[model samples]
Target chain A: MVFTTIVNCVRARGPDEFWRKRRIFKLAAHYIGRRRNCYTVAIKIVHRALVYATKGRQLRKQDITELRNARIIAGCEQHGLNFNDLREGLLRCNIMLNRKTLADLAAWEPYSFKALTDIAKQKTKEDGFGSVKDLQAPVGVITRGMSK
Target chain B: MSVLKRVQQWATFARIWHVYDATWQNPFQSAELLKKYLMGIHKPIYHPMNDCGDHVIVINSLDIALPGNEWAKRVYFHHTGYPGGATWTLAWELHRKDPTMILKKAVYNSMDGNLQRRYTMERLHIFPDGNVPPELMGNVSNQIRQIRPMPKRLDHYTKEEVEKFPKIIDYPKDYILR
Candidate 1:
């Protein structure tokens, strides 16, 4: 009656698990002390470091925005107009230049920036915004509103 | 432009100190000015969600003037989120306690109630007087004109300049002037 018996027991994880852990440890080889040699610690440290790398992507966006603002501010100063006035003028004239392009023109190309500012000033004047009374339209350039 | 040049351009950002004077200008107007700089609305790159603002250095805050009777009428309220914890202070009183509080509050209220507001406020630097620290002075690249012209003090006038000033009315010879 008891000639054959079958037993089921829990077994240890296979080599696949060990290899997964070994990969993380290998990537963390430069880590100092036990973090480099200990598989458990290396896994935790390397995962946390990866998290920071992910967050760094978002940080880069914020930095770019700040940089664009700086360039625009410098351009506005050069043209004797604040950022708001320039945008308002451009909007009235239906000029749809993006910030990156505007910043580029502001930094590297003064004549083009001045031309844009002149158009903006002319349009802002035509729109009846009273604050931009000081802006003088550049001679010999016809704007969108002027052609009609 | 090439992709690499465009990418390089994006990495460069300048930090500049913008000066604002509060003397004889309404707190709300000054606040609006500060808000524009704070929110980076003055820049072409300004976005509601981005922190692209420049540094705003406000001086002569003690001399800030308010339109109408707002100095006495405006009241700042606060609560501690408990029973009988509400507190109210007059604008003049608050300004007296801290000369920078009124402008700071005005600017705070003007911005949208979002997470970036606190970070924007950090860029605002308020000074009660005109004397800014030497270290901060070097960072200032441009000065924004005040909404109202600063009234010239009598001491600033030279003897020749005072003599040239037109007389409004002739005083009686017998009257002694203080």
Candidate 2:
């Protein structure tokens, strides 16, 4: 049947507002899930909602990576290279450390980042890339990287 | 003319498959405990019929720890019963060939013998690489924050990996001949 029909049939007199709504939708999905024509739609809706809820759980992590990256970028700027240049330094040198660990070092110790920058600059010069910044500008913007 | 514009979503990371990095130190001790965490075993919402395990992607499988001399002294036994058909091998030999197998076998033993276990095991992946392709898609990005308390893991070492480990083993400078 239609949503209105399921809603009317499944309505409850429960005191809890959230529980009442959950019961209504669940009953509706249950009804639809049993019907050949509507079962796919109902399951899709449920899975969609579950994934949406799960997605919310990942927000905290994204925020933190941004914060850490910001700190590292700032550290790089103080060394006369913007975040862009420093990343070029890494790419030019083919450094393998992940963003999290690299950022942590930048935030925790200044000299270490300087050391990495110095090493990267030397490597870039040896590679004939002229200033690691010219090389790194593109790498930092790579939006889709594989292997987390 | 009607046209359908396709939308492409680019993901930045991969799903958090339960990837475990095993050291030669502790590879297989509390494998049962890890199974519970990997499978989401302690949930009221856990449907025994459903594949409810979270994705885990592990690295450093070769670094897991094990107790005693199981790698050397303890022999894995098998037999076909022809003339001298019995066979046995030490864990040390297996270490060089397949380090991940030590822990994989432990996990297999801990999992229930059922269809659900099969699917859950599929989600539990292990790799030796330092980085993997991101499993997250679109503007969605997930960061890994592994401050969670680890459940006990199974022993990973042969007695040699354990006894030789610096964390457990110690010697004075004079003890070294060099």
Candidate 3:
């Protein structure tokens, strides 16, 4: 019943298949000799690398938090207000500005940040917070009135 | 809110710095506060699975208060997983050995028992005193109000300030000097 020509199983699959795997193998090119060349070793190395990549994403998130914390702290120190006082003051004024935005404003837009700080200082004063009492009021051009 | 506005909000992940003065603060209360910050429960975007917790920097941990003789009554136990390996340490003794251990342990115990707890604990920075490392100093953005007022130190009052302080009692000249 089987009267067909002989088929070759050991032949190359195709350029598409070859390149598809080669792409990942290329990623492992910098790997040690056999890990880069041998397809079997290359796949294993690639899999491990991918796992590291996934973990790297989580590490990146933590790094961002640390960076943001640093920026906010620097901003608070420059403005002579503790981070908590600034946040509380802002919260009382119904301004829910986040630390990232505040830090950005502190770095790039000094005038805008100053206005926010003044608002916070005023709110802290009204709330009877002892910490902000000693902070000097922003100099020049009052933006918001001193009222609750 | 519009979808675009919501997306914009989500895009800006702002991490907050929460400061706590552990001076005379009950460990349980401080632990609760730390948990709130560590779990991001205080924020509107809090989710159990998401890592949205804020950073907490605790100062004066050495001065943390233990209510009603807990310093002597409370005990921390540990074991080495072997025969006769069990060890018990009193709260005061532990504090004396490591000033930050009590608060750290309280907060650690309060956190959820899961893989994410270690990651959350990394955000918590504890200092024995008000002096923080210069590297971490920039991260402080806000302070949580102290639960109890810190007792005044004698050196804090100047000679003139002390003279102006109100006298609670006027002792008679005949009273024997201590």
Give the number of the best model, judged by lDDT: 1
Q: A50 in model 1: Cα distance from truth in Å?
A: 36
User: Which pairs in model 3 have colliding backbones?
Assistant: A83-B141, A83-B142, A84-B141, A84-B142, A84-B143
lDDT of 3 by residue, A32-108 (tens): 88889888889988999999999999998887665556555545655677778888888877898887787677655
How should the candidates be ordered by DockQ, best one leading? Answer: 1, 3, 2
- Identify the runs in model 1 with alpha carbons over 4 angstroms from their true place: A1-113, A119-148, B1-12, B174-178
Off by over 4 Å in 2: A1-148, B1-16, B78-86, B129-178
Count of backbone clashes for each model? 0, 59, 5
Lowest lDDT 10-mer window, candidate 1 chain A?
A: A5-14
RMSD of 2: 18.4
lDDT of each: 0.80, 0.56, 0.79
Worst 10 residues of 3 chain B by lDDT: B41-50
Estimate, for each residue in A1-148, the C-alpha lDDT of model 2 and write its tens digit: 5656555664465576666555546745544434323544655566677788789779868866766665666566555555655566577556776777777777556567778766655555444454553543323222212122
For candidate 1, list the clashing residue pairs, or say none.
Answer: none
- TM-scores of all candidate predictions against the true structure: 0.59, 0.35, 0.51
TM-score of 1: 0.59
